[model samples]
Target chain A: MVGYLLRRIGMAVLVMFVALSVNFAIPRLMPGDPVEQQLAAVSAAGGQTGDMAEAAAAMRARLGLDRPLAVQYLAFLANSIRFDLGVSVASYPQPVAEIVLAGLPWTIGLLGTATLLSFVVGSLLGAMLAWPRAPKLLKFLALPVVVLSAVPYFILGIVLMALLGILWPVLPVAGGYPFGMVPNADFATALGIAKHGVLPGLSIVLASLGTWAVAMRGMVVGVLGEDYIMLAEAKGLSERRIFLAYGVRNALLPQFTQLALKLGLLVSGAILVEVIFAYPGIGYRLYVAIGQKDVFVVQGIVMLLSLSIALAMLLLDLIYPLIDPRVAARSA
Target chain B: MSALAVRGLCVEFASARGIVRAVQNVSFDLAPGERLGLVGESGSGKTTTALSLLSLIRPPGRIASGEILLDGVDIARATPSALRRMRAARIALVPQGAMNALNPVLTCGAQFADLFAAHGAPGGTARIAKLLASVGLGVEVATLYPHQLSGGMKQRVCIALAIALRPAVIVADEPTSALDVIVQKQILKTLLAVQRDIGAAVVLVGHDMGLMAQFAHRIGVMYAGRLVELAFVRDIFATPRHPYTRMLIDSLPGFGARGVFKGIPGLPPSLLTALPGCSFAPRCPRAGPRCTVEMPQTRILEGGGEVRCHDA
Candidate 1:
């Protein structure tokens, strides 16, 4: 077990390095000057009357953008390892670390809850629907699940917003929390935050539940045909018990890898939903940084996101063997 | 009373093409401590009949009609809960390909423990250890997963699991077919010994006439979803009354008779269409016109056996 964990941690470090490098390199390599764009925005608003050239030069030097690419890359890498992300240009005068830290809790609270809820509910429904002797009605029900899963989250998010938000005035339309109610360390504040989080969380669930159901359905179908499941049935286990204990448990292993991928991918993909709802999450912060060319803030947030995914993937890899003894024995 | 008695059992499967008569009017009886061999080629519906006995066929498969009486109680008429109680405790099955039948993610001991727990057996772990040791596996094997074991070892674990509950009857469906020849013999020996020790009736399903002759006290030949012949093991091997049975016995390769064994000619009929007469008539060289016109009645031989052919 120790050996396996060590090996996984080693792989995680390599992955984190690659993720950070790509995150740093992509924005830098993009065509056009981010600083110039920011300057243009400032000048358009008629806020700056100083020499444009000198202002640009000073801004570039202060942000280390004028430094040699190699030196800047090295500095960024070192700063990332130490968690020393610089200040944001978009939200000027704010530290990048503070912005990320503020947003982390919301994303984790919303997405984590959605992921777990969807997995449990979807897997149970799928297992029931995939039984060899299930009625035609059950099979028909699975068809909608497959279709919904195939439809992209953005499309579903929009449809949900239109119908649930606009058509009916029952649910909150946009934003993570109510306006002017900043989250504070208090019971009332926590309760308020949870209440505000419900709508955005529901949107995420509505957008992704279909895919989870479809994937779980296929997994259950495959697991139902396995010999061990037959043996479980032959042992006189009730159909329900066999379905839940043996069938669903074995089927969930395959879904675990997909779940890990989905969680990691959500770090980036959450941007669309975050923007749609104007949720104060990491994704929304990222959007604002990119628009203002806040290089330091972008670098900091990207590194944190990448590091979180890397850590999660590492934990997932290490934990799999506990659920699946075959993997443990093989690794041993 | 016999442990299990099946009379006029038939199973049919509905498919897009048509209804398939997978098992037709199959009848058999197993007395306490009697070993019965159900011999047939692939698709002969032997497995379906076995599954029908337990009322466990998956859809679109259904037991159209049957009377499965266990110890004078009609199992076919039993409620679902009653049937579940009877399974594993009263009648257990050691299915075909036992090597892959174990849960890959569970330790062998844990799998055995699960079997005992399912049946509500007391002292599960200790009982599992005893069962494993009885099947020629060491106690250490309990901690190992299925994938860590060889094919023979896995089969042994399956046997241990099947006998864990000490069910009155154990159905082993082609249990040794997946193992090598030597391992097959060893596993078969272990199975017979276990049966002897427990005094449980065993239903051994296989196509090997020679192996059946050596282990089975009684042999029943199935062809095209119907039983063609049944007799004592020696009688079936020494003098097979049905032509299909004769062909199957003769098809077995003889020792040192290289290149001389003739395979059975013609294919088994598809079960989708209604079977007009004797299901095996099209493939039987000695089939008469009457065999093609009407289904033959099962006739009892003077030596105490049955054959489902007009000529016999």
Candidate 2:
């Protein structure tokens, strides 16, 4: 078992390296000229083009974009290993790692809570939908969920944003918190941040609920056919006990894997939801970095996203035996 | 009184094609401490008949009319809750394909505890261990998952579970059918041994005539949803009445100076369309005009057997 985990960790490290390498290339390949954009912003603030042009050359040499691609790749690899991604061109002197790290909590919090809530609710609804003696009206719910699931997350986010932000104006539409509020650990500020988060989170939940329910319904209904379920029934287990202990317990196995994969995406945040709500999450920050031609910041965010997913998958593999003992027989 | 008595049990399946009469007027009585073996080909309605005893048949299939009296109480008329209470407490089933009947995630001990707890007789580890021991399995076997055991060993766990609550009637549908010949015999012996120890009336369903002849006290021969012959195993074998029963006996492999066993001539009739007369008449050698025109009712022989044929 130790050897298996060690091998998995080894594979995870290799995956991280490959992903970071691709992340390093993406920012370079993107259309914008980072140095020129930075120079233009600085010159516009206070200086002549001639002096700023010389400063741009000096900045390029300092940032080492003047070197060959292979050499830069090695430097990025080493710097990433040391947790040192270059300074963001969008907000110069601030390390790319720092900006991404600052936004990490918001994205993780919003996406994590939204996805968890939806999966729990959706899976419950799905399992109940497949309930052997489900009420007539409850069975009809499958149609609406099927229709709702087909709507993509971004479109749903935009639609929700328009309804709540523009039409009703019931919830705050933009930013993580009020512009002049002094953010603190106290209850009021936390509440403000949470209130601001409601729309984006709701968008994510609404967008994903249908698919999870549909998937779980299929799995639970399929498990209802297994011989063990028949045996459980013949054992005289109550309808509720049989549904939960035998039905849902076994049906959740496949969905649990899907859950892990989805949760792994929490680090990236929901780009569409974040953009529509103007929530200050990593996804929105990523949008800012791209708009400001901050290549290194984009690279850092992508690297963080890939590394998290790879690590989450590794953890998933290691935890499978603990959740279901049948996997232990084969994996051990 | 018999442990189980069924009168005119008929099961039908409603499909897009039509209403298929899967089981037609099947009736029998199983006395306490007796083992009745049901032998037939696949799709012969043996499993359906067994499942209906507990009212556990799947949808599209319903018991059209029947009286399933367990210890003289009719299950067909019992309320859903009452039926649930009687299921594992009064009657238990050792399902076919023992390998798949257990929750893959659960250990043998968990299955035992689940069954015992659900039936209002919660069992501890010591009790479950003892039950497993009774089936020739070690106490540690309870801690082992079903996949860890061989096919025969899994069936043994199923048998141990079947007798755990000391149910009055145990219906085992082809318990040994999925195992190898050697393992099948071992499972059969263990099953009979356990049933003997508890003295539970057993209804063993299988396709092996020779094996059933040895283990079962009486045997009911079924073909195309109808019981053609019902008799003591000795009487059935010594002087077979129904030609279908005769065909089943003749088809078994002989020991000394063996000759090729002649299998029955034609396939069993479809349950969809209505039959003019006897179902086996189209396949019987002595099938005549009257046999085709009218179905024969079950006739009681002088010695001790029920034969459903015109010229028995």
Candidate 3:
């Protein structure tokens, strides 16, 4: 088991390295020179019309753009390992790491909870719908959820914003929390965050819940067909126990793998929902970075998301046997 | 009273074409400690017959009509709750496909715990260990999952589970068929040994006539959901009455027994649409005009047992 985990960790490192290298290369491949753009903007801000070429040269040298491509790539690799993404070309003064981290909590707080909530609630409901004598109405629930999953996350976010935010006015339309509200360990502040999150979080959950539920439903139906289920019945296990132990437990195995893969994406937040809600999150920050061609911030966020996904998947694979005895025995 | 008696048991499945009468008017009785082997080809409804005895048939297929009398009560007429009670406690099934018979993710001990708990019986480690030991398995095997065990070992665990509650009847549906020849004999011996200790009447289902001859004191031959003949181990082997039973006995590849190897000709009739006469008519060499036009009634022999044939 220890060896297995070590192997996974090694693979995670290799995966992250490749992802980070791609993150570095993509920005360099972009059309405009962000350093020149920053230089031009900085000179304009200082109200100086002198030495534009010299200023551009100084900016390029300071940002390591004056070095050879190989040396710059090596420097980028080293800086990335230390989480030392340079200052954003769009914001010019703000460090990309600091800016990205500022949005991390909102994304984790809203999208993370929503994503987990969708899996938990969706899987339970899906298992119920797939129950041996499940109600006719329960089977019909797949229709709306399928439709919701079919709608693009952003479109769902927009529709939710329009209906709940504008028409009903039941929840806040934008932002992670109340403006100027300090999110200390107080009921009022937490409630404020949840209230503001309702519309955007609902948008994400609605879109994601359907997919998880649908997947879980299919898995449960398949598990029910297995011969062990027949043997379980022949053994006289009560319907409820069989449903949980024989049906749901085995069915949840694939879902756990899916959940592990989705964890990294959740950290990035549902980009559309975050944008529609104007919620300050990593996804929204990534969007702004792309629009202004803030290469450093984009690279930092991408690297973080990729590293998180790889490491999380490794952890999930390592932890899989603890929950599933079949995998445990096989791995052993 | 018999240990278990099934009367007019009819099982059917609603498929796209129509209802398939899987088991039709099947009636049989098993006395305490008696071993009855149900033998036939695939889709002969042996497995379905075994499953329906405990009301274990699932949707699209049901015991349409039957009286599964155990302890003088009709299990077929039993409610869902009563049927649940009968399962594992009143009667148990050593289901086919032992490898897949167990919950793959559960340890052998956990499975025993489930069966014992359902029957309101004790299932601590010590009791389970003793049960495992009876089947020639070690206590350590209780900790291992199904995948960790070989085919024979899994079958042994299945035997242990069936005897856990010590029900009056233990139905083993093709318990040893999944195993290789050597392992098949070993598993069969384990099943018989465990049956002796538990004192449960055994219902062994299989197509291996030789194995059944070895284990079963009486054998029942089913053809297309109908019990063609059921007689003593001595009678069925020596002087089988039913043409189907005789053919089954004759077809056994025996050592040094030389005759032209005559396999039963033609397929068993489909149960989707009704067969006007005997399902075995097309396959039976002794099939006559009456056999082709009219379904033969079961005849009770003076010696013992019954046969459904025009020329029995």
Candidate 4:
């Protein structure tokens, strides 16, 4: 088991390396100079007047944009390994790593809770609906879930904001917490932060719960036909016990892989949700970094997201054997 | 009183095509410690009847009408909680293809332990070890997962699990089908010995009439959702009443007895649409005009046997 985990971790590191290298290369290769654009904006705004060639050269040199691509790639790789992402290009004084760290907790607080909640709710509902005697009401309840799952998260977020925020005025339209509310350095402050995080957290849950419900429903239906479930029934187990112990447990095994993969990919969508809610999260910071062409900030956020995904997948790979001994024995 | 009595049992399924009858008006009584072999071709409703006895049929299949009396208690009308207690504790089933029925994720010991746990029986390491040993498996077998065990070994585990509660009746649905000939004999022997030791009624369902003749005291032949013939094991072999039963016995290739073995010709009838008369009329050599228009009711013979046929 240890050896298998080590192998998976090794593979994940290689994948992360390849991912970050591509992330670094793509922006540099894109047509147009972000520094030049910033300089042109500054000049247009009448902030400064200087020789055009010298100013362009100074801006390029200052941003370290004149170096060879290979040199810059190696330096970025080294810095990435040591968790040293260079200063923000748009916000020159601040370090990228610091900015990302400050915003990460908010994103995790919202998306992470939503992910867990959706999986649990969806999986349970799916199991119930998979029952042969399940009422038509459940099917009716499930139709909306399928429709909602097909709708993009941003659209759902917008609809929810428009309905609940604008029409009903029940929730705050934008922002993670109330204005000027600094996080206190104690448990009470943490509680307060969680309390204020409800609407943004619920927005994510409402958006993603349908997909999980559909996936879990399909999983339960497939599992219901397995030989072991028949055996469970033959053993004279109560319907409820069989549903929970045998049916749900076995059905959820395949979903674990889906859940793990989603956990990693979800960071991308978290940015949009964070923006919608005006949440101070890594995704929000990433959006700002992209707009300002802050290479260092973008690199830091991308690497962090990549590492998180890799770690989650690695954890999932390890967890598979514990849930299913067949995999463990095969690998062993 | 009989150990178990099933009367006027009719199981039907509401399929998209129509209301498909799987088991119709099947009636039988099992004596204490008696082994009854339920013989039939596939889709002849033998397995369906066994499932109906336990009320294990899931929807859209249901027991439209039936009375399953276990030791004079009507199990068909029992509450879910009552049914749960009756199962395994009173009546158990060694399900068809049970070799693949074990939980793949759990160790054999854990699976057995769960069976005991579900029944509120005492489950400890020592009890599990003893149970494993009883089934001709070593203590090490308990630590292994289902995949690690061979087909025969898995079947043995399944048998051990079924008999764990020492129920009054054990319904085995083709228990030896997946096993090799050698393993088949061994499993049958083990099952016979266990049944004898517990003094329980054993209901064995299979297509192989020869195997049934060897173990069962009484044999019930089913054809297309109806019990056509049921007699003492000796009588069933000596004077087979139903043509289907006769064909099934004749088809068994007798060792060193050279005679052209005639396999039963014609397929079983479909149960989706209601048959006006006899289900086996299409295949029966003696089938007449009346056989096509009117269903034959079961008739008790003078010689302690039952046959459902117009000519009988």
Candidate 5:
């Protein structure tokens, strides 16, 4: 077990190192220069109009863009290890890490809850649909869920925003919370945030519900045919226990692996949904940074995304043996 | 009283073409601690007959009409809860394909715990160890998963599970067919030993005549979903009545029998269409004029056995 853990952790570290190298190379390879872009934007806005070439050179030196590629890459890796992402070019004087951290909580709260809710409910619905003894009426639910899953989540968000925000005027159409209200730890503020989250979160859950259910239903149907299920039934186990312990327990392995991968992509995957709702989450920040040619902030977001995915997979490997005895036995 | 009495058990499967009578009017009874072997070729309904004993046949196949009387309870007509209560506590099954018979993710000890807990029996480590020991498995075997064990060991674990609650009837459906010849004999011996320990009637289903000869007290020969011949082991081997049974016995490989192995000619008839006459009549060497147009009724012999052939 200890060896398996160490191997998994080592794999995760390797993946993170590759992600870091790629993050360093991608922005440098992009067509436009960050310093030149910022300088041009400032001149166009009529904020400063002096010494264009010299100011650009000074900005390049300050941002470490003037150094050799190898030196810059080594420095980038060292700084990334210390969580010291440099200043955002667009949002001058603000560190990229601080900007990313500010949006991390919102994205985690909204996307994490949405993903988990859809997985649980969809998996249950699918299991029921595949079960021979489950209610007959529940089978009809598959059609609508499948149709909803086919529609893009951002489109669903727009439709929801129109219906609830304008037609019925019940939910907030945009933003993370009410305007002019500082986000704090109080019942009223928390409730307001939740209210604003409903449209975007619901859109996400509704769109993914079908995918999870369909996958789960197929797995449950296959599990129902296994010899152990027949023996479990013949063992005089209660139907509830048989369905849960024997049926769902075995079918859940693949779904758990899929869930870990989905969670890894959670931050970047929420970009469209956050844009539709104008929510101040990491995806939205990444989007804005890319548009402003804020290379440092974009690199930081990509790094966070890659590391999170790697960490999720590592956690999955660690817990796999607990859920499935065969994994540990096979690995050993 | 008999431990199990199956009366006119007919199992059918609904297919695209029509209803297939997998087991037609199959009836038998088992006294406590008796071993009855149902031997037949593949698709001869032996496994179906065994599965029907515990009402384990799934949809597309069902017990069309029958009364499985166990300890005065008619399992065919029992409610869902009553059937559940009677399943592992009154009748258990040691399924075929021992490799997959166990839940792969669960430990052997945990599986035993589930079975005992399901029947409202108190299960502890000591009881699990005892069950394992009875099957000649080490106590530590309980802690291992199914994948960690070999085919023979898995079959032994399955046997241990079958006798865990000391049910009145244990149905073993080709329990050793997936094993090698060596493992087959060992597993069967273990099964017989444990069955004797629990004093439970066993319905051993298989197509191996040699195996039936060695282990069964009585043998019932099935041909195309019907019991063609049933008699004491000595009677079955010495004075077989039905032509199919005689052919089955002749096909068995012997010590000095050095020639081309004899195989029964002609395929068994499809059960999709109802046969007006005997199912094995077309393949019978003694088939006569009346055999094609009329069904033969089961006849009780003077020597205390039964046969479903006109010539008998």
Candidate 6:
């Protein structure tokens, strides 16, 4: 077990290293320099201080852009290790790490809850859809689930926004919470945040629920044909036990793997949904950073996304054996 | 009273072609602790008949009309709750393909626990260990998953599970078909030993005639969903009454005999479109004109056996 864990961790570290290198390289490969872009934007906005050459040179020195390429690379690595992601080019003087930290919780709370909710509810629905003993009404739900799964989440988010946020005016249309309300531990604050989250979260859950249900239904159908299922029924186990322990439990293995991968990509994958709602999450920040050419913040967010994906995969590897012993035996 | 009794059991499947009668009027009475083997080629409905004993025939297929009496209760028409109650407690199954017959995620002990718990009985660790031991498996084997065990070992676990509640009847459908020949003998021995211990009548379903000859007290030969002949093991090999049964015996690789293996001439007729006469007429070498126009009546034989043939 220890060996398996160590091997998985090693692989994750290797993946993170490659992702970090790619994150560093992509922004540098972009059309324009961050310092030049920031200066040009400021000048366009009619903000002037001194001569261009002196100001640019001073800015380069402060931002450590004046150093040799190798020195800058090493410094970048060191800073990243310490979670010091330097300053944002668009929002000058604001640390990239601070911005990421601010947005992290909102994205994690929204997308994490959405993913988990979709998996559990959708899987149960799907399992029921395949089960012969489940209600006919649940089986009828398969059609709507298939149609909804095909619809993109952003489109659903926009539709939900127009419906509940505008026509109905029942839900908050934009942002993580009402503007001017300071986020705190109070129940009212938490409730407001959750209320604000309903639209975006609903769109995500509605859109992805179908995929999980369809996949789970397929898996459950296949599992139902297995010899174990037949034996389980023959053993006189209750319909619930056979459906859960024997049928759904076996069918859920691949679904869990898919869930882990989805969670790993959650922050970045929710970009469009976040943008649709004007929600202040990591994905929303990523969108703004890209628009403003804030390279450090973009790189920080990308790096964080990659690191999280690796971590999620690592965690899956560790727990997979616990759920399915065949994996552990094979790895061993 | 018989431990298990089947009368006029008919199972049909609704396929694209038509309703295929998989099992037709298959009746048998299993004495207490008796080992009855149902042997036939693939698609002969032996497995279906075994599953019917547990009321486990799934969709597109169902028991059209029948009575599966276990402890005088009609399993074919039992309520779902009553059926569940009788299952594993009054009748358990040792399924075919033991390699995949167990839930791979659950340990042997947990699977055993489910069988016990489902029946509203406490499955103590000591009882589980004893059950495992009865099937020639060690106590440590209960802690392992199905994938960790070999094919023979998995079948042993399945056997152990079947007898866990000491059900009056145990239906074993080709339990050792996935194992090697050597392992097959060991598994059969383990199965027979366990059945003896529990005093459970077993309906062993398989196509391996040799295994059936050794392990079963009475062997029923099915052809095209009909019980063509059922006789004691010695009588089945000695004076096989039905032409199809005789041909099956002749096709077997006989002891100390050097001859070309003679396979039955043709495939069994499809059950679709209502087979008019004896379903085995096309395949039987001694098929007569009467056999083509009329279904044979099931007749009792002097040797305490039964044969379904007009000439018999």
Residue-by-residue lDDT tens digits, candidate 1, B1-312: 788999999899999999999999999889999999999999999888877766778778888888989866677778888888888788888878776798887788888776667667784566777888899988889999888899999999888877877889988889999989999999999999999998899988998888989999999999989998999988888899999999888888878667797888889999998667888889888988999989998899988899999988
Give the DockQ (2 decimals) of all models: 0.63, 0.73, 0.74, 0.62, 0.79, 0.83
lDDT-better candidate, 5 vs 6: 5
Which is better, 2 or 6, measured by TM-score? 6
lDDT of each: 0.83, 0.87, 0.87, 0.84, 0.91, 0.90
Backbone clash tally (model 4): 0
Q: Write the per-residue lDDT of candidate 5 for residues A1-332, one digit (tens) a residue.
A: 78988888899999999999988888778898778888988899999777999999998897788999999999989999999998887888899999999999999999999999999999999888888999877878789998999999999999999999999999998889999998789999999999988999999999999999999999999999999999998899999999999999998899999999998999998799898899999999998998977878988898999999998999899888999988898885
What is the per-candidate TM-score for chain B? 0.97, 0.97, 0.96, 0.96, 0.98, 0.97
Across residues A1-332, which tens digit of lDDT does each residue of candidate 2 receive? 77767877888888998898778877788898888987777778886556666787798898898899899989988999988987887677999889988888889888989999999989998998988688888778777766777888778777877898889988887888877899999999998998888888888888788888988999999999998898888888888878987899999999889988997888765886787777888999998888876767887888888988998888888888777888766765
Across residues B170-276, which tens digit of lDDT does each residue of candidate 6 receive? 99999888889999999999988988888999999999888899999999999888898999999989888988888888888876557778798778787885667
Better of 3 and 6 by DockQ: 6
lDDT of 4 by residue, A194-277 (tens): 755666677677667787887788888888888788888878777776787778888899889988987886666567777877
lDDT of 4 by residue, B1-312 (tens): 789999999999998899989999999999999999998888889998998778888878999998999967788788887888888889988878766788877788888887887789987878877766777888888889999999988988888888888999999989998888898888899899888988999999998887888899999999999999999999989888888888888888978568777788889888998889898899999999999999999999978899999887
lDDT of 6 at A257: 99
Q: What stretches of model 3 exceed 4 Å from their correct place?
A: A29-57, A140-142, B256-261
Please state the CAPRI-style docking class of candidate 1: medium
* C-alpha lDDT of residue A72 in model 1: 96
How many times do residue backbones clash in model 3?
0
lDDT of 3 by residue, A1-332 (tens): 77766777788889988998888788789899887777667777986577888878887887778999999999988988888888987887989989988998888888778888999988987898788687788778778987888888888888877888889888889888898887799999989999988888788888888888889989999999887888788788888889998899999999999988888677675787777788899989999899987867887888889988987788787889877867655654
Per-candidate TM-score, chain A:
0.84, 0.87, 0.90, 0.87, 0.93, 0.92
Question: Model 6's lDDT to the true fold?
Answer: 0.90
**Candidate 2, residues B158-273: lDDT per residue as tens digits?**
88888998999999999988899999888888988888898899999999998998899999999889998999998999999998899889888888556666688778888998
Off by over 4 Å in 1: A27-70, A132-171
Error of 4 at B107 (Å): 3.1
Model 6, residue A228: distance off in Å is 1.0
In TM-score terms, candidate 5 sits at: 0.95
